[model samples]
Target: MFGDAADAMGGMGSQEDSLVQIGVLVPLSPPGWAEAGRQLLGGLELGVREVNAAGGIELQLLVRDTAADPRKAEAAVSELAQLGVAAVVGEYHSVAARAAAARADALGLPFLCSSAVLDALTEEPTDLVARIAPAQSHSWRIYADFLLAAGHHRIAVAAQTSVYWAAGTSILRDHLAARGGTVIELNDLTPAALCDELADSRATALLLLTGTPEPAVAIVRSVRRDARLAEVLIGAPAGQPELPAWAALLGQDGAGIPFLRYLPEVFSPLGARVDAALRETMSAEPSFVAFEGYDTITALAEYLRVGSWAAVSVEGTRGQIRFTRTPGVGVWQWAWPPAQVADRDPAAPDRFRVLHTA
Candidate 1:
């Protein structure tokens, strides 16, 4: 209902035989993070190209733009399942991913989630679903530790009231409170008013747990301009800074604000080569979500060949991609991808600096 479906990519020279259809779910339209969706799609398309070229299990991609709507995602899964897709993959938004995961699980379809990491992907554990990104608790705790080490004991979070943000706020608060730190929640305030609350809290750091543009961009601009908040550190553990559009919007103000990223300090050989390819394809630096999408296909191709998630193990652009039942995570998980706390260099907003790694 949001966007027309496209038979985006198909393997060559498979006219006599049917190529396995992989339904790709992503946010390619507004309300969703469209930039993230395109990056992810770039990776997935690249993976599909490479996989087909390898000449074994053929694949065709049926793409649905979720627009970050949970209902759209669930309906997409149902439609895909009926279309006889062997597997479903991709999604950048956590809420949409969760809905898609639940539907896939109920329908007994395998869903390889690319980037959403809300911790509780499904209300109950299921072998039918798996994830490629590290859980929110896993990475956000690392962000929390980075805050503490950077001498930010009193941290504040300006967030929306989503399960994802609430989970992040709780993780930071619990992890920080255990080490004599406190978290302040500044919700529903206008960006200017947010700066006032942030200034009054005397919190050394403000973690942006809100979505991009509207409140997030406005809040960053307000805090950067506020004289009282000159010393307050702006952070986005949810990774607003990872988006290129963010820098284009905020420019210099976007720099030095640390956020979570899921790339290793060193890229694997496959990672290195794919990075170059994606850069050429995208004509810019690809976000980690791209790598996640590439890996999702890499994993799914193996599953398509072997027809078992347990038998799916492959080297992806990031590292060795494998799935296992992880504790606290309700679905099969990659266990983790590499996690880092990074920020754009204030000197050159295009350049990113890796601060902490795990």
Candidate 2:
């Protein structure tokens, strides 16, 4: 009967009769953000391969590119719905995810997000939109904790003024105040002005809340070059992998700064397994974004196979993966930790690990 139902949904062959069709919408051509999107998709593909091999509800992933545009994301969601996909995943950008989630809700299809960390994603939650990564609030809280533990009482925040950064800043400020630390300075800096502001701040630590690595490197270099700010520690969200440029820019000092990452040491074993699989299958290193893709699909596929619609939760490679319905939206929670970077080697600052809450 399950097999028959699967086939009736269309495109399921005899071998695939119990398989679910999952739609993945991503920004394969996001003007300048193409590589990140490609890496995320590669992770998704590896995840699908592993799950199918392990004998679960077979999943046929239908992929579409949203080009990092909100309008394109809506169109992608429509296209996925028309293709009879049971669930939709992706649109890594927060803006794109918000646009896509609305459409997914309208169609009553499950929307799973891997990257979008804007506070708005969970603010007006619905049952149809779920996430497999920590929200921006959680990331910022963790970042604040790291700074507090490092004996830094005064800090500065520099970030883009986007929805993601705004939410992160709110969380950071709240946490910093609670720890008896004052945010002496907060600035909205362009790519160029970010350096000048950092040079002028008297804070001992700088917390950055941005998405990509390029801007982060620029900011780090600015601080490192300033004689007065040499002792100032720098940190950012850990989601940005240690790209080569970041290493070159930070050199040895980058290792001293902490980064907020979600993957906990408790989940290291699981992360290692997934990381190994990703590296083996995709010819690329597995990032937190990739882990998000893996966990979201695994949870969704399990829910489909068991036919349980009740709120389901499971441990993911990085953190907890679960679905819950809110008044206006559905929220997905992933396991994440408030962590700090312990040390940095100029050759491998990107390899910083996390120290979770005890």
Candidate 3:
């Protein structure tokens, strides 16, 4: 859900209060991951309402639009710092998060990345940086394991031409090869090209590594339309299942195609509550970004309440929420959210079901 419910509380607007201020940096408009940002805002607003309803300390938010641009994200950090925020949260793009993290580090502000998953974000230990989403590399291993367990041995990869996609594909290729899986072909992602590649290769499975929803939908449509690829198992190694628009765009072509994502509702009561709240408020299914955004706010509120990020791990909707310092990204805290492999049922293409939780 979006602002229908939270707009009444002025959740994303300026609040006149002496309470603690947290900067919310998200792509709220064009060039930003707007849909994902909207979902995140829904969860964030829900977290705010829950915290306040429970008589937590008063918290005000200083919201900024990053537009998924690194330069703009960096500037937003500076502006938030100028606004005297205690910490910052929200950002779904890895590139934007990286830029914002650097600026946050320089500004001495604690930053919780809600969904960005570039591996280098945690390579160095700094007190200012932490992430609620695991690095892309971490998810790849989980996806690799899922593919192998699903009996996929001969795999072909069709990836979008981006550094992020390239990094993940490389890891997938290596991990699969180590497990005796063969990568029959690798090529740039395109609907027609992928269809031809799948037909030409002896692969039993095709891995589509892409970040955006349009291309992913196109690739899935291509596979469904091509007789040669009709029987091939399709795997989206990134967070396609987490995209709010994926199923709607994919339609019946989404049936049986497995995609990796962070699932907050797998046996978590808190996750269920958050999901239900968002659905009611936004009139849409909650995505992984929403779960992470909610958790980031919950975690930050806890930090403000207890005066220590160390003692504030909540049973996050995404997973057991705890922070540990890792060598990468120099952030003092990092959260490794649990991953899942999910798919749309052939009988009910609109319904997404979890195939495996990693």
Candidate 4:
């Protein structure tokens, strides 16, 4: 009886030792942007649960919210590190990502990011920092190409006074010039001033890179109010999902204007399958914000499962995820809409399709 008891105890100990634990750090309440952050956290949780349900992952997940503050981000990282997480995933803001990356680097924990677009996040690219989202520069290039291909030669680039716009302006300017489209006006415009400028530009197109949706709506309303600006194409950053207002406000005229977008088929069949699986498990829809979270956690889990520490590359639903030899600027695929299809369906924004490069 004593020998049988000993064997049973040994088996129980082995079973308990098989499980592995991983850390998932996210913003519980993203300051100024709660919805997007909530979706991100939801996706991460669903991904974790899904992985566990399928024969269970070797790693268990530890989750915490960063509150979207840089200081809080640092604290979250520290907390996760103290918990002895093998990897940390989180904080959608680029600034917050950078702060957490610094902390993760210090603690020797791998940090994966979902929504941070600023180029500065990976500036010091330690092995710890990897991103599922393409850099901001890539978005600018796609937007510029979209304008040029739409036969928009003389363009006006307007944006709010923010760092996001500042970085985008330089890249947009370069790409516009390269494509032989002159950026005739590059100014910071408030809601009221923006309306006045659009009314006056008489330019072929207006490219807006503002973070807030208010100004884009204002531009559309101003254009509708004036017939001269009616034919002028209006474009805004793809990140903001408030384009429905422009359509509702301007009706048919808004349909004629283009909104630059990346991953235009984000809700298509392929995307829908992934989204549906996540939703069914987590009870939420997926967004660009959540995509990074899902991909990062998936990547790290795969890395842990495969024991491929030297393998610097992985494939994500959005694009390639890999580390570059460069200390900063990890290698990633920027899946932009092909230039030929930039204005493919300006009249039907919802029906627009993306053409990927071969």
Better of 2 and 3 by lDDT: 3
Candidate number of the best TM-score = 1
- Residue by residue across 1-358, what tens digits does model 4's lDDT show? 1122113122332353345555665655635355556767776766676566665344566776666577888888787767656667766666677788777777766676767667777445455566666667766576677667667878887766656677777777787777777775646666567657766766778776654335666666665676667677776654454223334454554554444433434444534666777666654445555555666666766655443333535555555555444322552322322222233245565444453221
TM-score of 3: 0.87
Residue-level lDDT of model 1, residues 1-358, one tens digit each, is 1110112213322333447788999999989989899999999999999988887557789999999999999999999988978779999999999999999888877888999999999999876788999999889999999999999999988889898899999999999999999999999899888888888998999888888876798889899899999999999988889989999999999999999999989998899999999999995589999999999989987766555566678998778888888889988888778999999999999999999998
lDDT (0 to 1) per candidate: 0.87, 0.65, 0.74, 0.59
Top lDDT hit: 1
Backbone atom clashes (below 3 Å) for every candidate: 0, 11, 15, 4
The residue pairs that clash in candidate 1, if any, are none
lDDT string, candidate 3, 67-164, tens digits: 88889999988987777677788898777888898888776677888888877764356655777888777777888888899888888887766667
Candidates in order, TM-scores: namely: 0.94, 0.83, 0.87, 0.75
lDDT comparison, 2 vs 4, better candidate:
2
For candidate 2, write residues 118-213 as lDDT tens digits: 657734555556676666665666667767887887888776657666666677778888879877545656645655666676678877666555
lDDT of 4 at 254: 50
Alpha carbon lDDT of residue 356, candidate 4?
Answer: 29
Candidates 3 and 4 compared: the better one by lDDT is 3
